[model samples]
Target: ARATVRNARALAQALHDRGFDVLAADLGFTRSHTLAVRVEREGGGESVAQRLAAVGVIANKNLLPGDTSPKHPGGIRIGTPEVTRLGMGEREMVRVAEILDDLLHRGKPPEAVAAEVAELKAGFTTLRYCFAAGEAAYRYYDLVGRDPP
Candidate 1:
């Protein structure tokens, strides 16, 4: 829980620095793992979410003020729970923001961004806040039937 809050705060700052209009900036960006971004100018929330997902940055389309339909909202909701569980910190958040900026503003290809995302993800395979520290979160199917290595 603590790591989630810390990483979420870092992500909010990174997103703000990369020119995304982060909501509730006056309230220190966010209190939980979720951060809301207004993406009405670049595209609607749904489109932006799809673009991000295509580049391996998963996010959800969300409704902001003046938005009535779920299909076409005005904001994108990003969260750090999974990454935090993977033990990412502020630096990773900044990297993620850069990836988003490249994909969203600089017109980078999704495959290119996905390469970077994969590299970043490779370093954090062990999950945190569950099991023993440093234990692998997922076990291989072949190994599952055997004794612990």
Candidate 2:
């Protein structure tokens, strides 16, 4: 939980540094909810996630209005522990951190993220037993599966 919070804070700070108005708030009124981010915009062209990503924030869709815990909610949690297990160093962690912000904020199209997710799965050579690659694929799958348009 601490690690997740740290990741969230780091992501928020990165976004703020990159010219993004970061919203530091909890979402969903549940124990296992999540932290949320709302990237303020002007013309309203990009999706909230996309706008946030443009700067560096990765807003989890599960986040409602006030929640914390990635175990089973909207907050997308990123932890360095897994990368560390995979033999990734600080620099790699930073890069993965950047990727987290990108994956969340980019509001990647289902197809695009899906492709990325596939590549990520293929890259999971460490059998280090992490969840990001798989979770990413599942999330993208769910998103694509629920496409209403």
Candidate 3:
């Protein structure tokens, strides 16, 4: 829980520093494993979420003030549990923020960012904070199909 929240806060701060409208930033962004980025543009949440997915960075479309329907929202929620469990720390959050800013803010191609995302994932192949020390994260998922013990 501590690492999750810490990573979330770090990610939020980094995103915010990169000119993103991170929700509840004044209140330390959040105290949970998640943080929200409000993308109050024409396409908004769904659009941003899809773009991130194309770059191999997963995020969920979230409703915000301008959102009129669940299918179309104005925010994207990013969670930290998976990365945290993969032994990522605040430093990695900085790199994540760079990817987001490049893709979303600078209009970088998803293909270009996908390579960066894949490289980052490859660096953290083991699980931490859960499972036995030195356990393989992806293999554990493959063995269980879902849920972790």
Candidate 4:
């Protein structure tokens, strides 16, 4: 739990440093694992979310305060819990920001960015913050019905 909080702060800082306008910066960015960033300059939240998703970085399009339309929100809400659970830390957050910058700002192709994401994810396949270590984060669908040996 403590580690998650620390990682979240680091991730938020990393994103902010990479020129993403973090909402509520006056409030220390965030108290929880979630960080909301205003991406209206690069593109609206939904558009940016789509672009990030294309490159395997998932984030949500969110409606900032005073904004009404869900279809065209003003912010992208990101969280670090999943990555934290995957054993990523502050340094990894910086790497993620670089990938995002390359994709969104430098016009890198989705395939290229996705390869980078995959390479980063390769080392953190086991789940953390759970009851057991060495457990696979994802289940093979074909093996779902089989019992563990």
- lDDT per prediction? 0.86, 0.41, 0.87, 0.83
lDDT at 14, model 1: 90
Which candidate has the highest TM-score of all? 3
Task: State the displacement of the C-alpha of residue 82, model 3, in Å, after optimal TM-score superposition.
Answer: 0.5
- Residue-level lDDT of model 3, residues 121-142, one tens digit each, is 8899787867575787767567
Kindly list the per-residue Cα lDDT of model 1 for residues 58-101, writing each as its tens digit. Answer: 89999997888877899999999888887899899999999988
lDDT of 1 at 35: 90
Candidate 3: Cα lDDT at 3: 89
Clashes counted in candidate 1 amount to 0
Candidate number of the best lDDT: 3
22 Cα displacement, candidate 1 (Å)? 0.6
Worst 10 residues of 2 by lDDT: 25-34
TM-score, ranked from best to worst: 3, 4, 1, 2
Backbone N/Cα/C clashes per model: 0, 10, 0, 0
lDDT of model 4 at position 11: 75
Report the Cα RMSD per candidate. 4.0, 9.9, 2.9, 3.5
Task: Evaluate model 4: give its TM-score.
Answer: 0.88
In candidate 2, the residue pairs with backbone N, CA or C atoms under 3 Å apart (3 or more residues apart, or in different chains) clash, namely 26-65, 26-66, 26-67, 27-65, 27-66, 27-67, 28-65, 34-67, 34-68, 62-74
Comparing 1 and 3 on TM-score, the stronger one: 3
